[model samples]
Target: MGKCKGLLERLKNNESIVVAEGYIFEFERQGRLKAGSFVPEIVVDHPELVRKQHEEYVNAGSDVVLAFTYYGHREKLRVIGRENELETLNRKALQMARDVADRTSTLMAGNICNTTVYMRDDPEAIKKTENIFKEQIQWAVEEGADFIVAETYSDLGEAMLALQCIKKYGKGLPSVVALVPHSKDHTLDGVSFPDACKQLEDAGADVVGLNCGRGPATITPLMKEIKKVCKVPLCCLPVPYRCTPEQPTMQTLKDPKTGKQAFPVDLPAHTCGRTEIREWAEEMKALGIQYIGLCCGNASHYLREVAEAYGRSPPASRFSTDMSQHFIFGNRKDNKPYYSETLRKEITTANYK
Candidate 1:
């Protein structure tokens, strides 16, 4: 309900910050709903779903529960004829996160993203984009957001504008600016990653790094490059979908080696497992990345792995073990079989070289 003092203190003290991804569209798709432009509609209509997601991330060890307002801005809502509910949707999004955060004492972050109008010479577009960001940031501050995140920009200029808006109306709350590079080294607009990091840092971003567009394998090298020029805190939250030059979005993604679709249309089939995610977290920690999180296609299970990898026990561990003692074949409870006593005893006594 108040400012997120604990998170601010951690950032100021140079401690690692575990951020949970604020992805709502994918969950909507799980319920067989349209996902493109109506995601905010679902947030307004299904507050409980969003709250349950926030709670899952909190239990998975997120220090911050970001509001599900990634694309709830005016333009986005206008596409679905819901522009009138922009303020109400954004406020409700933050409220859902706040409600869950109160239970765990986790911090809350108000989220905004690129406006997709990055033409610097277009005065009309620039003014419109500024107004868009201004309105969103105002709502975020009005709703008592602890911090703000302007992420997933493909153009450095757009990211700069968002950062400027945040600096102007963020009410001194810390802000993170995360870009989505077309490749590992440069934004889609051709700005080098280092240049983007420097520009954002100069524009008053508290933390700067990359998000979306690529997975951990591609982002690792890019982060190493960012570390060279970025002195401020770094953040990384890559999408789980595997991508190729020809196919970037989850629906179009393909495996580079196999030359085939990497996953079903609705599921993140290429998501890294707990072990791989842990390795990514460990590497980022070594690289002095103070802010680490997941992006699109991330789930509570992935967040739990990140928390456990960072030495925090997942809340589920309180009722379960890392290893399972029983195996089920199907949903039928009565027909299930258990491991034989002799086999269980032998496994318990098995020796390794």
Candidate 2:
């Protein structure tokens, strides 16, 4: 079959692409994967679940179906004693993603994240990391992926290595590289966010920006900084959480009731509502971020709001909220005249009581 329009062609035409990440966290929330391990063994164990998620994101208006191969690398699998299944998992994830993208007419991106074993000045660790990236890139290329997405790297070196591997093995496929910074607003190795983004662009990344970690509140300001220095398209995919300046990253957020960290789970209280996600999408558009998505705490519903904000109505938009149809807050003229004026007034003012 013929390839769909390329990512660069769409972006060059000034289109806003919505990518839906966060599969590991979303599946963990759904009880499909382990929380701490986060290895995408589901691609090998329950392939149907992976396919269903791709369908959900596509229906929710994601223009890209990024393979859920985020941490499906050598290091992570080794941790779980499943290193023998590395190639199987990566290839399975890519094939599953490609099938969904082909059926839904969305872009399929091969995904690779930080090796979690990179050292700043150690050559041996860096070499191993590059090898880890190379093997994954080979499978993505062989699977006919549309592009490669390398993300969630706290170390600039690791992110750069991922990009390098993609460029060498991707066979002309586009690359989207994103970093995940902590509270200090800099990479772990002391490079500032803006500087690291600039370096990535200079190193031939097709698109460069930030992802994961900080939420809209924190990532927006950093995107503004990166935009000023980089001429390439900037991507902004933040976690769907109400992150504040005091608690800049999700990991630092606390349970107000229990007075303990509420990251991995127990984040419902801190989750950003649909309204908040819609507003954040609007702000990202205003800031000129071309690649907009929700990271770790994302859901299809949250992304539907994002798609609506971007002015594109995918199939899922049919179910979008219409307050006029609400039983209490609705104002449709067809409502039965059963309630008296006093009752209507009381209902409207009930929240104050």
Candidate 3:
């Protein structure tokens, strides 16, 4: 939103694309990582060092970097003793992002995830979540975030609350809201696609889009319909595969894989169809996502494939291995050089195995 006008122009231009990597520091289902206390644990114990991963994504031709603060909401941090460190943690994430974005003109999108949910969707939970936006947004501005993305929302209520908070505080910053595509193409609130976009538009979101779903084929018709009606800009995010979160990232499969262990697919898991994935990319470009990005199932090679489809070549130095076990390493945002003694010593199959 600041000092990045040319960058924004590139994005605004025809057929532009960007990719976001990771839920890295985020807590998985049911909020397993307890707030502040677990930040270090999540990073240190998560097996993958995210910085290097972010860098790898950037190398794969991604134009934007997403901060790994998806679960960094105040409430989560409060679960741990580091409620006080909320600002510190959020700011550090921005700084880490800045460090990664520093090398190239790549932009950083600060996360305001966890804004949408049900069961916990009542007024009380919403109020607590609002405070999280307040804190994180303030820190993001202070730490120089280029943009703010409230991703993976299932409903519009949390979005409304978040937008209300933005009006109350965020004077001139640009914001993005990415919805999860569910039944009827409405948010979990039953707010229809048109209605959701309008509400989010009214709520001060600069760009509105959809991400984390069954891939492009399932999303194209709705997206086309959405484009016909919406006034603001459009963005699109697609995963590498259609089936499982841990579905085989074949192009993404790692030869010297590190991070989480992969499991057998027969046991009920996330999976994405490759045909669907390729079609999704082609259709998304056709359907009009000035900014195109690949989500979870994406690896450096996967992104390179998408970029090539768009007539663009991948930037040099991208490397990623899909999980045969469990974890997949994303863009290497490690500010540290790979030639450094520490990296050379630490990056090995023996260490992880």
Candidate 4:
């Protein structure tokens, strides 16, 4: 929680936003909640890709860079047969960040996601998540992370359980819990936003915010609801992936007969990219949101655009020469030292046991 406070203190100065993001695995576009064996070329091997994303956000003026481990939550990895490699995967991701971040003031929070699927329906599912998240928090703390964000939680009970794991094994690491809102204006499991806020605050969350699901336009209304009931700083990490009834893509496609073989189709209203991120940040500022960030589709340039807007300036382009100087993706050669450190004491009562 104290680590999260580092970003909070900086916000009190002037227009400030949390330059943060979602977990980017190699197979992000492979499927929704896909549990197949991870392709080596597609995952942790590309730490440089992850590092650059974080650096670009920092350069574009993000205050925090989350390690790319959202789904690294132990139980989810277990679903894909890589559960035992959790420690190795986590340690490698953080090291990648440590190498490239030199310019801006940024901190690294280990990210713990909800189970690949919500675990609210089954008691055993719930217990599995509790154990996995607790292990993630401790491992992140040991691997030199700055804080923790238990994010993308749909069911309130699932979120509450994740928070419980953090409180139990966080070893005093500061944390923020990102809650997903339900259709009736409550948590997916039927808890009101205000009520969920109270529980998180009671459990000592340093910052509470929302991400994924809703786009920027819908988020403004949602932020208002959170502001009324929550008293801590808030972060907004939305998804970068686009969604439609059947597919989500950066560009919708159509066959072309002429110049280029293919081109993007179109997006209906209620969905947009960069423009939507700008509009959403502006709305949050109006609502007195102290912490600002992007979740899903935004890259570092996108984050910088959001940060520049927070400062009341024009959004910086990703290719501007100024950006070249600021974005640092770290030192990623074919080989680098790997670490195996554990930040927690025995889960005296092993959830596994």
- The most accurate candidate by lDDT is 2
lDDT value, residue 265 of candidate 1: 44
Q: Rate the local accuracy (lDDT) of all candidates.
A: 0.77, 0.91, 0.61, 0.62
Better of 2 and 4 by lDDT: 2
Checking candidate 2 for backbone clashes, the offending pairs are: none
Give the per-residue Cα lDDT of candidate 4 at 82.
79
Residues 1-353 of candidate 2 have per-residue lDDT tens digits of 45578899988888889999989888898788898888888889999999999999999999999988999999999999999999999999999999999998889999988888888789999899889999999999999899899999998888998899998988988999999979998999889999999999999998999999998888899999999999999999999988899999999999989979998787788999889899989999988889999999899999999898999899999999988875556787676356745576886675755
TM-score, per-candidate, Cα-based: 0.85, 0.96, 0.71, 0.72
Query: What is the C-alpha lDDT profile of model 3 across 63-109, one tens digit per residue?
Result: 77777777667666666556666666676677777778766667877
In model 2, which range of ten residues has the least summed lDDT?
A: 335-344
Predicted candidate 4 versus true structure: per-residue lDDT over 237-345, tens digit per residue: 6544333322322233123334231212222222356666677677777777776776654565566657766773322443533422321322333322332112122
Better of 2 and 3 by TM-score: 2
- Give a tens-digit lDDT track for model 1, residues 249-349: 45456665666755444345566666777788888888888889888778777777677666677685464333343443233445446655556567678
Q: TM-score winner among the candidates?
A: 2
Ranking by TM-score: 2, 1, 4, 3
